[model samples]
Target chain A: MIEFLQYHLPVLLIAIPLIAAPLAVLLSNRYIVQSLALAVCWTTFGLAIWMVAIVNQSGPVSYELGGWAPPYGIEYRVDQLNSFVMMFVSGLGAMVLTYSPYSLKAEIPLSQHYLFYPMYLLCMTGLMGMCVTGDLFNVFVFLEISSLSTYALISLGRTRRAPLAAFQYLIMGTIGATFLLIGIGLLYQMTGTLNMADIAEQLEAQRLVNDGQWAGSRTMLVAFAFLTVGLCIKMAVFPLHTWLPNAYAYAPSVVTAFVAATATKVSVYAFIRVVFGIFTPQFAFELLPLDTALWSFSLVGIFLASIAAIFQQDVKRRLAYSSIAQIGYMLLGISMADVDGLSAGIVHMFNHALIKGGLFMVVGCFVLRLGSVQMDDWKGAGRTMPWTSFAWVLGGLGLIGVPVTCGFISKWLLLTSAIHNELYPVAILMLISSLLAVVYVWQIVEVLYFEEPSEKAKHATEVPPLMLLTTYTVVGANIVFGVWTTYSAGLATKAAKALLEGGSL
Target chain B: MFVSIFILTLLVVTAITIARIGDLWAAVMFTGIFSFLGACWMLILDAPDVAFTEAAVGAGVSTFLMLGTLALAGKTEKPTTSSSVVPLFVVAVTGAALIYGTLDMPHFGDPNSPVQTRIEPSFMEKSQSDMHGLPNVVTALLASYRGYDTLGETAVIFTAGIAVILILRRSNDGFKSNDVFNSQSNSRKGSQ
Candidate 1:
């Protein structure tokens, strides 16, 4: 049993949910579907934890699907980098599932509740598969899996415009997926292999001189360009982020929470995997010069999206814009191109998932009782529903990089890296962006805490215990981890080392 | 090369016709025709698997869905005499970039190209043994060597099915028991 589990755990992380997804659809009872989804999520999370530990003990583990050998097989290869990500994605999946039932009940109609579980599990399956697979083409297929599920989940919102929002997202996502497929096809044409390690090996060999002059072809460069641009669109990077705000804002609350937590983070993971895992950093940075573009986009995206967030009347929309800006911070860390910088990026993404996930859950609670998440609707809601409000405030603090929040630690790591790299201006930019985050978060804080209780606010009550419990579990982790940063930050640092050193020692 | 060029010219003409047609349904039909031409092109290029997917998806599924959408929104497109400057500018820039990017690619079907030289030889040579004597190399690679990708594609299709059902099917309305391609009135009858 132990040997079998050791070999098969990675695929099972995906299979458990993929199998559960169809089963949930077959069953009509909403409660059964919910329980099944929750069970699947927890099991995947447990498997992720167990697999990561085994990987740490035994260095990188390579499992070929159905006993096919590498360079000719679909490889479920886990290194420190992806295992760290696997843990984050699956753990978030489980936590969000715990939080979904109450929100789904409140937001989705009775007849549609059973369907939501299947979609949610399918989305989780897509993300988990994307993170674990070591094949380039497999990433695109899973990306579509997650993207299609997300569109449907978003359209399940009660708002009249939800379908339109979903349609817009579907169009943008399909275009992004197509661009990605074309990019992967180009790579396959160039390298004649879909396995990432084999491609990396070929590209590295192609770097050698035919007659001492640089032998790498421009066709490969174009392939890299297409891949990067396609991933940027998928990741909602800066100018390509037009489809994100409305999609997140208009989606049903549970959908937004899960997607905002996992989808973009996994997209970023794919982007990194393609760049650093498949193509060496020297080639990416020196030959392609993408870091320059990344840095510029991150700098502008941070300021612009944060400024947009500050002016939103609806709280969910405000947070949606804030997500774009937070994405910029993660990009900023990645653009620094060193171990410390990469750790900062990875840690910040994980922290942001928890922060943003908890924040969106709070919004779900507000939308549940108040039927709206506009700032006006929140007038003195803090007084009426103290626990939910408190959780929201805690989540807000994490977003603002307060001292006792997860956000602060990541920002500190990022700032120190910026200074160490002697990018003084970037250090200053990081500080300025945190202040911008504070301004938007403060707008939310002022409404939640300072305003007088409206009549409806006075009538508001705490969300059900399970929902409240789940939200605080995430919110409280932000505070607790900020004080003791060894585990989370340590894993991130190890992941960074793995990527920078090319593999685990 | 001659066949490919002829198919390519036809494809360009189809696209231009699609652009010029004001009848939305006709444009959709032209689009399907274009996809069929593309599938034929792929078949001539010796990628049967890709040709099959393009035929099924680009021609079949896409046309079906476009028709459904046309039925939902009115089929008749409004003809506007608006200036096409912005669109033309965007098209020109995108076309220029794509053409420039294609300059570095190996010419069609060049056996000596870097793409044909690397990695594939090993797969083809070793597949009889490595793939456990699978008769078809592509099937072996797709099912065993690249099986994870197929799994993901399965999820993608499954997700698409669930997505369309969620968006278009009214849950528990009894109409859902009717086929998705059924006309609205037919579904209404099922609901009744």
Candidate 2:
């Protein structure tokens, strides 16, 4: 029984949410939907915790679907990396679902509340699916699934702007999907195989011999370009991030919390997979000079997004731009292409999700109480919604990479990696960006605590108990993970080693 | 060579239809046609799996979704005029760049190309041993060796579905009182 559960655990993690998604939609009862969504999320979260324990003890585990063996059957492979990510994604999903009922009551219409739970489940399933799969084309297919659902989730906002935001995201997202598909098609044309490990093996075999023939082929180069651009768009990297602000701003608070927490992080994971898994670091770095390109683009993204974020009046939009800037830090770490660098990127992915998820949940609370999240609307909210406001302050400090926070650990590792590479300027740039983060986060902090509450806001009470509880849970995790990095950071390091060694070790 | 030319012309026609069709509904239908033609081209290139997905997702599912959206929004497109030169120039540049990129590419279906040389040998030789009993190499690769990516792609689909539901689902209480913008318009018509 123990072995059976261990082997089937990955599927159960995904299945719980996948099955519950449609069930939530079918049940249509508000209370039922909330309970079912929470149950599924918590169950998956528990499974993730168990899987982590199993993986820690046994190393990586690969389970083939329907008794089919690899390189033929669909395989779910869980290692240190994905297990850690699973914990974050599933844990966030559970907390957000817990918070949603209260937030939805104020922000979403009664008729739409039932749909929220199911959509949340689907989104969680997509993020988890992305973390666990080993196939290339399947990645594209799953990407589409998550993207299509995200567009719907974004549009569910009650604001008039929600439709327009959703439409814009749809357009950009479709373009990203098309680019990924074209890239996959080109790769298929070249390699005739969709298995990333198989492709890597073939490439390696070819490289062992003096095989310069296919090294710089147009088809391969084009494939690389498509994958990079598609991922960049999905990650909301600097130039391709136009769709993010509005979508995040107008999206319902729960949706914002979930997407901001998981979406771009998954995209970063995809980028790492393509760079290290499919192409191999040698080919990607030496043959294509991808590392250099990634470095420059990420640096630019950090500065530009930070500058852009400083001017925003709407709190959610401001955070959206800040999210873009945070993505730059992750990308910068990835571009370093060293062990510490990859570890930094991976750790930051987990850390940022916690900070952003907590922050957005707090925003949701504000929106619930005041019915708006504009800077002006939050005036004097500190005095009324004391716990919620305090959580936001801590989350904001984490976003600014304050000492003893998860964000600081990631930033410190990134800086260390940059200095190790003797990229002193890059290190300085990272610090500057953190300062920019401070500015934007401070802007919200000031509005929430320093400003006096207006007459309209005087009657605003604390958000419902569920929301406060959920926000506090993530916030607590953020601080706990920050102080105790043994598990999360260690998993990231192991995952980085696995990736850097090309799964051989 | 002749077949390539034929497919190219068909692609051009569909592209023009997508660009120029005035009715929003008609434009969506044309987009579906465009996807269908592309799938056929993929089939011709000997990629049945891709062709299957293209047909199902691009032609069938996407078209159904577009039609559903049209029903919710409206069938008729609001008339608006915009500068054409920007789009034309953008297309021209994109077309030129694509052509330039393809210039150094191995010719279509060249059996001796490095891609075929490097990959085909292993696929023909080792795939059986690698996957044990899987007959189809593509299926093997998609589900097994690279299954992690497939999981990600599945997640992408799930996310898209969630996003749609979240955006479209109504709140528990109901649509707001101010949701009756159309009511004001109806009253004006009544007054008229």
Highest TM-score, which number?
A: 1
CAPRI quality level assigned to candidate 1 from its DockQ score = acceptable
lDDT of 1 by residue, A1-505 (tens): 9888878888888899999998999996988998888899898899999988988888888878888766667777888777878787888788888887767765666788788889999899888888988888878878888888998999886564677788888887887888788778877876778888888877777666454222445666667777877888778888889889889877888889889999999989888888788777777787667788888889899999999999988788899889999889888888888988888999988899989988998888887777677788788998889999988889999999999799998999899889999999989987998898888888777888899987668888988898899889988989987888876788888888888885331
Q: List where candidate 2 sits over 4 angstroms from the true fold.
A: A211-216, B1-4, B21-106, B110-192
lDDT at A333, model 1: 87
All candidates' chain B TM-scores are 0.79, 0.81
Every model: Cα RMSD to truth? 4.6, 4.7
Q: Give the interface RMSD of each candidate.
A: 7.9, 6.2
Could you give the interface RMSD of candidate 2 in angstroms? 6.2
User: What value does the lDDT take at residue A335 in candidate 1?
Assistant: 85
| Candidate 1 chain A: 10-residue stretch with minimal lDDT | A209-218
**Residue A430 Cα positional deviation in candidate 1, in Å, after optimal superposition:** 1.8
What is every candidate's C-alpha DockQ against the true complex, given to 2 decimals? 0.33, 0.31
Global Cα lDDT for candidate 1: 0.82
